[model samples]
Target: MKTRTSKTIGVAASAAAIALSVPLAVTAYAQPSDSDAPAAEIPDPQGPECGAFKEALPNWKGLADLPVSAALASIPEISTFNSAISGGMNPAVNITSVLDNGPYVVFAPTNEAFAELPPEQAAYLRTDAAGLTNLVYYHAFLGLLGPDDVKGQRPTQEGTEVEVTGKGGDIQVNATAKVTCGGIQAQNARIYIVDQVLDPAEAPAPITPTSTSATTSVTPTTTAPATTTAAPTATTEPAPAEAGAAEAPAG
Candidate 1:
């Protein structure tokens, strides 16, 4: 009786172990290596071709589906963006930074804009990091405005407000001059090429209040009081004064 009981217990334990092993083997077969996992999605970039200028930059094939920065970086021009830092014309870099949160409608002045600046200012933009950065920011907009979207007034990246006007039924971004190229769409940035370059310094400065001390110094002095003719000081009638001179005469 004892032997039979022991044999039965051993068989049951063996079956349980076999069942566990089968599930473990199935799990191992189903698992895959990290290396064999799917690849991440990337964006594509496409824009209108304008001669050599377009080809020099890398063809961002998938930029339309990508984040604005990722798309810009994919372009060949972005690699040379630092080189473009000359004359403080760093619009390329500036556009990329702001585009992350924008559907910015930007009037990207051609390299000519920087060249148009005086040599001294251009030199400072290229060499002075802060100036270069500010100049670049001045050209960007926070909205995703397209050519058709431009209307009324919009503020510049520099915080100066500018009025926009269109031509030939087509809209253009203008401060003083017309933007030549109409539009180039990026993931979030709508870039347009301008024949004339923008000059942030051209905007007028705000009026400053005069200091109290200066106002006091400019106060007008009091004028002399006006004198009138005394109206003949009792016009006539001092005549009797001599006649009446003596009451004693009457007596």
Candidate 2:
């Protein structure tokens, strides 16, 4: 009996130990290990060109005091545009004077945008005075327009209107060019960074055709009166011949 009781106690203790160890084993397995933890997200590194561009922009406090032309001159991203305006690419346009004079909204294209242009067109614009002048003027609007004012049709300095449309928070000009960075303020005007260059040749000129049509209509009217007078003379002469025939028959 004594041996049996000792054996029963040993079995109970063994069972209890297993129950405690099973819970501890499960707890140890459930806890996450260092290797199982989520990895930290790596940040995207800035490109060299982008870094240089950011460094070239004026500091926040000083930007407001600078004129639009000066502000544009300070940014490396738009250096191509600034150079075109200042370097006499278009002799007729005084871009510096225009930017200094008033409240204009300039849609400045990035250097990348210029580089993306077709080689032939880019070459022509680099040397063609009229084309360059028209191209620059097409991007400049007369008054200051913020992002909110950018919607709808707006007249450009080139004497033509461009269509501005906003959809899902994206703004597009002429349904082709898009505004990348907008509402940048300067002392004389606002500057919006655009992805593409605005071409004046693409804008519609309805007035020219309408004027031509008016001129063509007047030309036909002037010629019609002369034709009518000649027709009457021919009829009069034929009547006289018919009278002469009647006189001949009587004789």
Candidate 3:
């Protein structure tokens, strides 16, 4: 997987100069068939969501106090996403309200992400509430999962599971979509701003984690005929360049 770049507005700013009394750490999911992971208990006062400083944020309230709907409105780069959710087209459905109550993880696509969609497809999603809502639901995972919390393959609420890989800051959704900016929070959920819109129908097959058995097979003491043959393991080791890639080191 590749390294994640902070696409959330202000992530590149000088947070150190802001000098908040509280120190925050930055950290780093998905599916097409509606993700329904159980809500996690990670504390809200401080979370990986606090990846960057926002001078505009209210001093008395943290992002955890606001709902997902409100949080989307706060980020400028994802305004198209904000508009799409708000405009889910049908007056009968309230995408905003659903997000407001979620402890869900939303892999929010940016305005540019939306622009990447085929004109016809984008137009249809915007006009059909059920279609739009389903698409949004497909992008979310039930419960709060930060970057550190995301691992392996997890089912989505939309109707299938998505593959998540990488640790720390370099997370990949379906092994391709990159987390441009991650860990933004709402009172009930978390956000990972992704560069591409994830589709369950098009997602790659789930990734199977490397099994421990492969490494331990050498431990068996029996002189099995297979053991007599020498196998090369030079390819299994991590390359030198991949050693400590994180969401960009603090600074």
Candidate-wise lDDT, in order: 0.53, 0.69, 0.66
Superposed by TM-score, candidate 3 places the C-alpha of residue 126 at a distance from the truth, in angstroms, of 2.4
By TM-score, the candidates rank as 2, 3, 1
Per residue, candidate 2 scores C-alpha lDDT tens digits across 1-251 of: 99999999999999999888785543344788898999544222122233344456536335557888888787778888887777555555457777778788787888999999999998898778788887888888777666666665566777776776773236777789877766666777767777898887676442222444553211121224444434544334343455446454564
Worst 10 residues of 1 by lDDT: 42-51
Q: What is the TM-score of each candidate against the true structure?
A: 0.47, 0.57, 0.56
Sort by lDDT, top down from the best? 2, 3, 1
Off by over 4 Å in 2: 1-58, 88-93, 167-169, 204-251
Highest TM-score scorer: 2
**Candidate 2 local distance difference test against the native:** 0.69
Is 2 or 3 the stronger prediction by lDDT? 2
Over 4 Å off, model 3: 1-61, 88-93, 204-251
Best candidate, lDDT: 2
lDDT of 1 by residue, 132-151 (tens): 66655666666765556555
Query: Candidate 2: RMSD over Cα atoms?
Result: 21.8
